[model samples]
Target: MTLLSYAKAMNRALADALEADPAVCVFGEDVGAGLAGLTLGLQQRFGAGRVVDVPLSEQAFTSAGIGAALNGMRPVIELQIPSLLFLVFEQLANQAHKFSLMTGGQARVPLTVVVPGSGSRSGWAGQHSDHPYGLFAHVGIKTLAPATPTDAYGLLSSAIRDDDPVVLFAPAGALGVREDVTAPLVPVPIGAARVHRAGSDVTVVAVGHLVHQALAVAEELAGEVSVEVLDPRTLYPLDRAALVESLGRTGRLVVVDDSNRFAGFAAEVLAVAAEECRLLAPPRRVTRPDGAVLPFALALDRALQPAAEQLRDAIRAVLK
Candidate 1:
């Protein structure tokens, strides 16, 4: 078995996409130098033309990528910082995402935007630490947050091949995750949820890096409570069927998301559950406080983000 790291898995996925399709091109700042680790060695392999590094303007380059998509090129834009997404909201949300529907399916924007090291990074402070996947989802953009190296590889590959504008957020907390690969990497379908562990007491829906925390809590609460860990890899076009099925079995839910609590991705999941599924007890959500801006201080940052203990408590609360 080969040990694959999450960052390496993403790099490999990008390399494979570059090799498989000439229409696939990468555009971003410092992509030639591979500062984000996901584009490492890709420029050398794919040549400077396919892996073009653009000017330091997020809006300009993002619009350029959208234009490239219109002209039959599948462009993958890598934003080194997640908050840069806020800078190009008009280009992404109003322009690229709406083009296909506006044209009545005449135009397709096969653009994949990758935000590596998304979410909180130690000492990166508030500006670089935002995990804004929810905003993209809210605007009807296809959003992905893969929790593991394997999921990272598969979901990224699928994102590159998608016909619509897609955003993939590689959470900083899961970047160091590693997994053993015994099979060849393949594309995982979008809007699918994976049940990491089976349980009958509570179904814990974890997003992005919180999937790891949910699994650990499940193992710890094995004797007293049966906790099922469900990873909703795709934030938008959520796997509502899988969610309903899991909640139907357990009759309890606890969503642990890295985003803020108000109108966040976790809130959407809870809304879906409340509307469609019958629960034995009230569902709980463990998420960051509303309007939380991560502090630069290490201790304060850790305190702001969701933790394993919080997830454990949420799970138990649902069970009770």
Candidate 2:
């Protein structure tokens, strides 16, 4: 029922969660001033106690979230840069994520670690430009990347409510996208994949911001071939059933992911398709080159990340 930017949608989602549940709290560097833009006005509405700002110690604050979650608080920790995740990997992968299973399901950590602007953002360079969702996914942590404003709002709400630890990667590419949403904002269930466009010739599985590029490419090739655009909103518990169903119809697959090619999210999708799906040709993945470190130069940075043209070429080759 409103038009909202991707960043505003996430801000609204956080506000909604805070208003709806008293137990839901947020902590991160600069959240008090809403530096990431997703927490703007939240600290004012919820007060400093609930929307607290922490020191610069990412490792300490990340584990503090785990501790808060253990005490029945739903804590959302925002990382200003995507690579900050690496700084707190042990806290998340070992402490928060493993609590539920390690305790034999007796304890649950409802913690949401949000990377607001992941992937290369112009000249942010190597340290700030990493899209590391695949790393979290490989560790079996609940991972999500919503491509649209609506999905951003819905999925973030769901992630906060989930019993397990969830990591949300809001790509820099999608941060500026705005949508005219008529329906009331609501939670989108995790582990569900949405078919953005239906087609019979090929299925293009796109992750995070790449979903928009995939849809655009699908439309551009509409006359030549029917390309199905599939968005697996949740990366960890990937909607394998939906993937298999799409593959059943399309018989071909091409994945566009922002992460690196080696053991990346796209690689996992291709690997699964190879193991279980019937394909007309060898599947292809469009991702950042293996071990790619985005450079400070704009052209060099753009070259390292997967492009729409690359996806189109991959789709064309897959259909060939």
- TM-scores of all predicted structures: 0.99, 0.99
- Candidate 1 accuracy as lDDT: 0.94
- Please give the TM-score that candidate 1 achieves against the real structure: 0.99
Model 1 RMSD vs true structure: 0.7
> Per-residue alpha-carbon lDDT of model 1 for 1-320, expressed as tens digits?
99999999999999999999999999999999999998999999889999999998999999999999999999999999999999999999999999999999999999999999999998898998899999999999999999999999999999999999999999999999999999999999999999999999899999998899888888998999998899999989999999999998999999988988899998999999999999999989898899999999999999989998888788777776
Worst lDDT run of 10 residues, candidate 1, spans 311-320
Pairs with steric clashes in candidate 2: 1-182
Alpha carbon lDDT at 75, candidate 1: 98
Report how far off residue 117 is in candidate 1 (Å): 0.5
Cα error, residue 293 of model 2, in Å, equals 0.3
